[model samples]
Target: MEILQSAAALQAQTEKWRREGQRIGLVPTMGALHDGHLRLVQAAAAENDVVVVSIFVNPTQFNNPDDFRLYPRLPEADAALLGPAGCTALFLPSVEEMYPEQSKLRFDFGSLEQVMEGAHRPGHFNGVATVVSKLFHLSRPHRAYFGQKDLQQVAIIRQLVADLSFDLELITFPTVREADGLAMSSRNRRLSVEARKKAPQLYKALQLGVRLLEENRPVASVKNEVLQFLAMEEAITLEYFEIADARTLQTVEELTQPQEVALCIAAWLAEVRLIDNLLISAKSL
Candidate 1:
């Protein structure tokens, strides 16, 4: 696979592809290859004639400077995995390449940016939107693939696409997990062995939420059960657990007959912060 490290190089290749009428797919990710990310690449490759995977750990998205500093970067290993995973090209850009000037731009997603991850990490989504916009412009893919693990991120990006009128399909795949059910993530590498074992509890708690919602329990009760479940785990501290509307992401008080809702949770285990969510449909609820 050809590795395009600069925006000009990516645009030149993709522009040539577009002229030849080749269908293109873009999978945007932060470098630190894991099965989860490879899954995105595979899915993108399956549907499009040409696939471009952008690997750049965006500094703007990190709320904590330390977290940014600690984020993983394994370019060689990442490229190795992508070569065999059907990736046609890799868009590996640098911070300076992406942000040539000191960018003061910010994007607001209204209520979508007001809760859960957004509430905790100020300017996180703005940074996400900014970089994603840059990637979308640079790659100019026919479609973009993302995982369901970042439910809120998917939501935010969906909004960004619509508001900006980007002519591309947005595809979301299921969250890839380990055999033990821990959601695969770049940050998972930093987890202590014991913390890794405890990590699955987040998914387990999400499972409890799904069951409670299926039984038509009150939304608050379902949220409380998941919160209490996380609370009982000494090693994992609950950040926030909310049963929010799938579209608006506003926390709900009661089920009110099972509309589309998501059970989103975030927690801290040792130095790793993990987030997971389960989507509940009206038929299931």
Candidate 2:
């Protein structure tokens, strides 16, 4: 696989690929490659003739600079992980290359980005949209792959494609998990052994909430039950637990018709903040 560090090189190489008529696929990542990220690349490999994985820790996407600085960068290890996925090229651009001048323009994604992660992280998704929009334009892939772990992000990107009319396809995979059910994440490394053990409760609570919803219980009642479970655990401090409209992400209010919905949560398990979610039809009850 080829490793490209410069934008000019990426453009020139992609131009060559375009001339050769090979379809391109782009996988954007924050560069701590794990099973989940590779899963995305694996999907990209299957769909397109050539897969391009862009490994840039977009500083714009992080509201916490310390967290951004603490993020792991194992480029050599990451490259090895991509080998099995058949990643043909890597677009490894520097931050300056991504943001030459300080970005003055920002995208307002309306209500779609205002709740869930957006509310918690503040200007986080604006940073996400800016860099993603840039990557979409730079790589100009026929299709881009993102993981379903970031459900709110998926909504924003889908809207971005429709509103901007970017000539591309967006593919998503289910949130991956550990054998014991903790969702896979690069930050999983930072968890102490004890926190790691308690981490799976996030998913367990989500599943329990789903069961309660299916029984036609009130949403607030179900949410409280799940909160009680987490509170009993002591180690888990709930940040936000939301059961909302899957599309607009507004509160379900009364679980209106039989539409699909998401139950999303963010919390601190000890010192490590973990996020996870589950999706089910509102009428599944």
Candidate 3:
């Protein structure tokens, strides 16, 4: 796989691909590759003639300095994994390459930025938008792939694509999980042995919430039970557990009608922050 590090080099390569009439797919990621990430590349490779995976640990998106510093970086290992996954190119840009100067521009999604991940991490989505917009422009791919594990980020990017008039299809795959049901994450590497053992509880809690909701239980009651369920796990510190409209991400209090619902959760397993979600259609309601 070709590793293109600078923006100019990447754009030139993509332009050449475009001139050749080859369809391109872009998978943007930070460099700690796992099976979940490789699955995205494989999926992209199956559909597009060329798959470019960008591995840049975007500094602006991190609200906590410590989290930024502690975030995993394994470029060599990532490249080794991506090679067999059919990745055509790896856009591994440095911080300096991505941002030569401080950016003055910021993007706001209004209501989309008002809850859950947005509320907990102020200025987070703006930074995500800034970098994502840059990637969308630089790669100029016909399609982009992201995991449903980041349901909110997908929603924000969908809005970014629409509002900015970017010409590309946004594709999302279901959240990848371990045999024990823990959603696979790069941060899972940072978990201590004991903390790792308790991490699956997050998915279990979400599963319980889904069962209760499917049984026609009240939303408020389901929320309370899920909260109480997580509280029993001393190792996990729950940040937020929300059942929101799948598309708008607005938290719902009652299931008055049939609609897609996203059960989202974010919590701390030791110092590593983890987030996961489950999407279900409330047709039974």
Candidate 4:
């Protein structure tokens, strides 16, 4: 696979591919190269003639300095994996290469970002939107791949594309999981052995919430049920247990019959914060 390090190099190579009329796909990732990320690359490979995977651990996205400092970077190993995943190019840019200086500009998605993940992570999506916007502009791919592990991120990116009118498709892949069913994430590495063992409970709790909703339980009771279960777990501290409209993400009171509800939960297993979610059928209520 070709390695493009600088912005100019990425632009030049992408331009060459564009001149040749080759379809290009881009997978933006903060490296450490897990099955989750490779999944996105493989999906991109199937649909596009060429795929470029950008591996830059963006500093702006981290709310905690230690977390940013502790983030993993393994470019050589990542590049080797990309080659097998049908990636044509891998962009390994330095922090300065991405942003020589910190950017003063910021973007706001109104209420779409000011609750749940956004509520807890101040200025997090701004960093995400900014860097993603930059990557989309740099690679100019026909499509970009993102995993659904970060559901709110998908929501935010979908809004960004529509509001800014970017000429690219955003395809979200299903959340990759461990054998025991913890959602795959770059941060999963940060969990201690004890924490990892308890982590799958997040997904298990989500499953319970799904069951309650499917059984036609009242929205209030279902939410309370999930919250109670989450609270019962000594290791898992609940952040938000919400039942909201599928589209607007606004919290709903009643099921109101056949409706789509998003059951989202965020919690902390000690310092390792994790989010898991499920879509529920309104008929259960």
Best by lDDT: 3
Q: Model 4, range 164-253, lDDT digits (tens) per residue?
A: 999999998888989998998877888999989999988888888788777867878887877887777798888898888766677888
TM-score for every candidate vs. truth?
A: 0.97, 0.97, 0.99, 0.95
Model 1 TM-score, 2 decimals: 0.97
Predicted structure 2: clash tally: 0
Relative to the true structure, candidate 4 reaches a TM of 0.95
Question: What ordering of candidates by TM-score runs from best to worst?
Answer: 3, 1, 2, 4
Show model 2 residue runs off by greater than 4 Å: none
Global Cα lDDT for candidate 4 = 0.87
| Tens-digit lDDT string for candidate 3 (97-138) | 999999999888999989999999999999999999999889
Candidate 2 lDDT tens digits, 77-136: 899888788899988889988888999988899888778789889889899999899888
Which lDDT value does model 3 have at 96? 95
lDDT of 3 at 38: 92
Of candidate 1, the 10-residue stretch with the lowest lDDT total is 252-261
How well does candidate 4 score on lDDT at residue 77? 84
Taking all chains together, the TM-score of candidate 3 against the true structure is: 0.99
